[model samples]
Target: MSRQRLEHYLEQMTLDEKIAQLLQLAAPFYDEVGDEGQITGPMESLGITVETVHNVGSVLGVSGAEKVISVQQSHMKNNKHGIPLLFMADIVHGYKTIFPIPLAMGCSWDIKLAERSAEIAAREAAVSGIHVTFAPMADLVRDPRWGRVMESTGEDPYLNSLFARAMVRGFQGSDLKNDKERVASCVKHFAAYGLAEGGRDYNTVDLSERQLREYYLPAYKAALDEGAELIMTSFNTIDGIPASGNRRLMRDLLRGEWGFEGVTISDWAAIKEMIPHGVAEDEREAALKAIIAGVDIDMMTSSYVHYLAQLVADGIVDEALIDEAVMRVLQLKEKLGLFEEPLRGADVVAEREIIYCEEHRKVAKELALKSCVLLKNNDVLPLNKNQKVAVIGPFALSGDILGNWSWNGSTELTKNLAESMKVISPSNIIIAEGCSIDKITEPQIHEAIKVALKADILVLALGESSEMSGEASSRSNIKLPEAQLQLVQFMKQLDKPMVVVLFNGRPLDLHGVYEEANAVLEAWFPGSEGGVAVAELLYGAANPSGRLSMSFPYAVGQIPVYYNHFNTGRPKPSEDTTEKYVTHYLDIPNAPLLPFGYGLSYTSFTYKDLVLSSNEINETDSLQIKVKITNEGKLSGVETVQLYIRDVSGEVVRPMKELKAFRKVELAPGQSREITFEITEEHLRYYHSDFSFTSDSGRFELFVGPNSRDTMNAAFRLKK
Candidate 1:
């Protein structure tokens, strides 16, 4: 029988069978590690049985093609409906081949690399039994305090949009149903979940409708356009409704208006937590709300399996809702070719041998190098081989180089910064554990201070752990934790040259580092080969070109900082000192430590003469903006050419500027290129006051820059 006919026949079975089809259980990853190194704990002992799994439609965390096939054979051996279960994994960066964490990939700003990484992840995952990935988060985030910024691209909707599309295409490939290596792409957190209040994880998100459509919605829509097969609801609510239970966000905006013909899944255990969200009175109400809102999969929440069928029978939810969800899941399975020989691509030995393969490592290294943002360089970097380098801080020798959220990476397997630097220049490198991360005791501060007096240079590796900034990880103070600040101050007292290599998961207030360290590298948890990558860049083996996709704040008090924030009528410039009756804090300036799109390299470049192809254009026409960039330094280097546009006037006031396009350009010394970025009416479109997307007849300003703050401007007009 055809897969469609089988799906139809299954739909005709008892409501019990339909409920079984929508249920998915957590599956354990086959690779075993010691208790401390495992990414997640076992779900096997949670009263899970083959009978329960047989009643489920999908399984997550299960891999190894042999294991997948074995499980399939078991399902066929006992599953009453005889349905094949789909396997999913995080598979964010790469399956087992450690790549630069997603934030590091953001620094590369290369869609092709993102796509290549995803393709490789798919290839490895497919070898085992994985068919779906909860990746390419595509959430437009600017708050560095929110730890998952490491998983997203960055603040700008445009760059984030491109990254999102690339990731979806990479995961899904050209055709998903027929390609074994290609898994279904799940575009996540459907709406404005990124704007969590106070940069807190799972916090309330309240955004204006224009802010919602103009910034957040585009990336998800772009990912969907690129054929994302699943959508995951965010942990937060839009307004007062948790996204999992909101009909407007899930059913209306996503499926009804956007036409996303895919299964909507809740974030792990979200469906059951609707009671805590105060949206539902009980688990039964939560199940009804989520299903009615078009959520198909419950993730780890067994609430759907326990209460959904009864909800339908009680008339709280329609049987049609069940059918709608079942159809989407079946269609996706058919797309994956699961109906015809479910184990078609299953090759357990090949999967085990190939996962985390070497070539993926090479790509990961290249990406890691690209993601290292040079925040500050005062002619102190490009270290001379003759100079003795004093590497100070707990992060120096602690091979806990694996960034946060690495499920299975251990310090034993991970390379420490000291080791990678030793590989670079063994004899010249000195070491001292300045202090532990948040270690208030400062037992070794004297040793670090002593090393500082003798060494010609220093590399201070200090930052938070992988777990310090994800999921429930929210910080009230995002400064260098504890003695780290005191150590930097102590090192500064030595009057020697130093570079602070920060291995943090979030953007931190590096005011102390900026004052003391000669150079600063914001290495936001470069994964696996991070040590090697940072060492190479520090030694001038690789020119530091990674730019800050998110803004760095001066303090956690300046939370929710970004480049495109709406300009207030009483706009306070950096120099504005009128403390009386202004939208300004009496003590602090309304500016971040490092503006968005800010990153520095060894060599300097200058942008001159902003020119447009034409001053005016219609909605369909393209306006070309060009700038001549000179590599005004001795060393050859790369520059990320950024293009930002502003709506001078709108029905609703727009932000000062919005990032439209950017490109990473490599130039030899004395070489100049007039790079032209094409701007279209499509780029001009923004959500209007009435919730309609339209481009208006208005004067627009084009801003070109090394970073958002360092910019040159010109004007153009777009007509109806």
Candidate 2:
């Protein structure tokens, strides 16, 4: 059906049916029904009442296409108007063909691949009868301690923009109306949830307009530009108002300013949490505030379902507001092609065939390998096949492979790194669980040291699990969990050369390991194929190319560290320097353990001679900058050539440097490549007071290199 036809169909629905369409119901874990039906979980549960069949607006926590179809059909069976329910799930990464989490994919710096991954996710999700995916979390993070940062694309607006647009395209496809299985992308956490207070999950966000526009908000606009059909508001508040009930954010900026035509959704129980935010007296008041603020759907919240109509009856909320929100909700269901064939999408054969296909695994492996950044290597990496390797860590044997926000991740069929290595090279592998990820005993340390003594090579797997650091799992200190670090220290006592394989969700402090490990590979929470990918990189099957998207702080006390930090009038030059009255810390440095865009490879690549074709430009002029890179080592490698531009001064205090453009290039040993970056006027524009974007002419600096810290700089000037 056309958008016109869908709109007409929605207009024809009755008020009760419209209200039913607006409600999103809660269900238990999916998998109760056989093929050919939408399996609403309550049908098989013990406490289900007759009201469940009639009053359920939608179903949550569902799976399988046929089961969803059965559940939706069941929902319509007892309804007066037979309105089919919207089936929602946390399809954060992927549906069945699970891709890498957004952070790891962000590390890849390959927008096309990210887009393709989403495309496959959308295809698999849609085929399974899922209408929407709560994905492309576009929130920007400066604090790596925030566990949910793992869910975001990364800290840079430019990188987030590309990934957000790609994910939106992947989920929505070319058109949702014609594509039977095309799922709508939901832009999440409406505003800056990334700068959560002290890096705690679901904490408050406090940001100035200058910071909000310059740092956050851009990726959201980009997703909106790409036609994201739904949006999930953050639990975090902007200023003092919770995002779910913040009318200025949801209504003013999102709806009016950005002109987003889609429905706005509350994160799970976020509307109810407004009471905790102190904005609402109770759940009833929370419902009133949220609907008044223009929220269209309440996910897993009884706030809207239990009290929205009551709020209308009490005149606390205008009926027109309900109509407007209900309209958007019904309109989105229409966009999902639900109106034309409400009960026809569930396909058992598609579900059976699509989940965990070889192609998906190949893509998963590619993304996994691409995400493994060689942070440091001293000619000890790319292990020889003949070497005897000892793999140590609790995670190596545990079923804790997947990172955060994984909907259905399991290690049931997965080969842990130790097992995977044996498959690739049978005779040279040894497995030993040295220490737990958390607290460890002295005997564990003794065992680890013993393993190192007998081994020619060691691969230490260390990082957080899928559960330890996401959503409710924020950590104050984002170092490797204590026990494992002690094990690393113990292993360092031995003379055997070792490699540190990090499987973390956030940028962790590897300060101590800088001197201890011979080689370090950042294998950020790679999904199912994580082990296989790590094995390949360790054995020289794949070269490490991924780079850090967020800066790893030296300590959590240096919370909001990044490469684009502003220069204080009296900026501290170095950590060694003392502070009399200047901005310098006595114990810790202001700098991160590693800067953003930081990554290393076994093969050394050198960047030289920054070049710019035009320094002065207008809205119409294009600035071209080039940098020469040579692969100085004896292997083929890939490099992400980053171009950063800094505006000396502006109408607003600008970041020290903003990522202008970056391109990933492939080069063989002894080969040279010149990468050019096109800087348009839009790249220089900043959101001014009154929200109008304007640029100022000034002397600017251009830098290009392996990472933000390792760059060669030059100057250019902008003209009026």
Best by lDDT: 1
Error of 2 at 503 (Å): 1.2
What are the clashing pairs of model 1?
39-407, 65-128, 97-356, 177-335, 404-466
Candidate 1, 1-720: lDDT as tens digits: 465686675656677767767777666622432333232334354344444555678877777776677777766655666567788778787776667777777777788988888888788778877889888788888787788887888888888889899999988988876787788889888778778988788889998777888899989999999989998999898878999999998888888898988888888888888899899998888988889888998887667777887777787787888887887787777788887767856787787677766777787788888889998888889887778999999789876656665664445766778888888888988889988887845469778877777789888888887778766777878888868888887888777888899987778888777878888888877777788888889899989998888888877777778889888887775546765665777766678888888888888899998889999999779888889999988889999999888999988888888888887899988888899899899888788889888888989998999889889999999889
Candidate 1 positional error at 338, Å: 1.8
Candidate 1 local distance difference test against the native: 0.81
Query: Where is model 1 poorest over a 10-residue stretch in terms of lDDT?
Result: 30-39
**TM-scores for every predicted model:** 0.94, 0.94
Backbone collision count in every prediction?
5, 11
Candidate 2 residue-wise lDDT, 1-720, digit = tens: 465754564577654454555556665623453343344455433233344335445566676776677776765666655556777677877765566778989999988888888887777776777777888899998888788888888889988999999989887788787887577788887889898898888887888887798779889989989999888899999989999899998899888888888888888888989997899999888988888788887776566656766776777777778677766766776666676677545688877777778888888889888987788888888998888888998867754667766666666755578887888789988777888878788777777777777789888988777777778888887778778888888888787888888888888878667668999888888887888888899988889899988887887788788888778788887778866566867788877887889888778898887888876777788888888999998999998988888888877677788898888899999999888888877778888777778888888887887788878998777777
- The models' CA-based lDDT, in order, is 0.81, 0.79
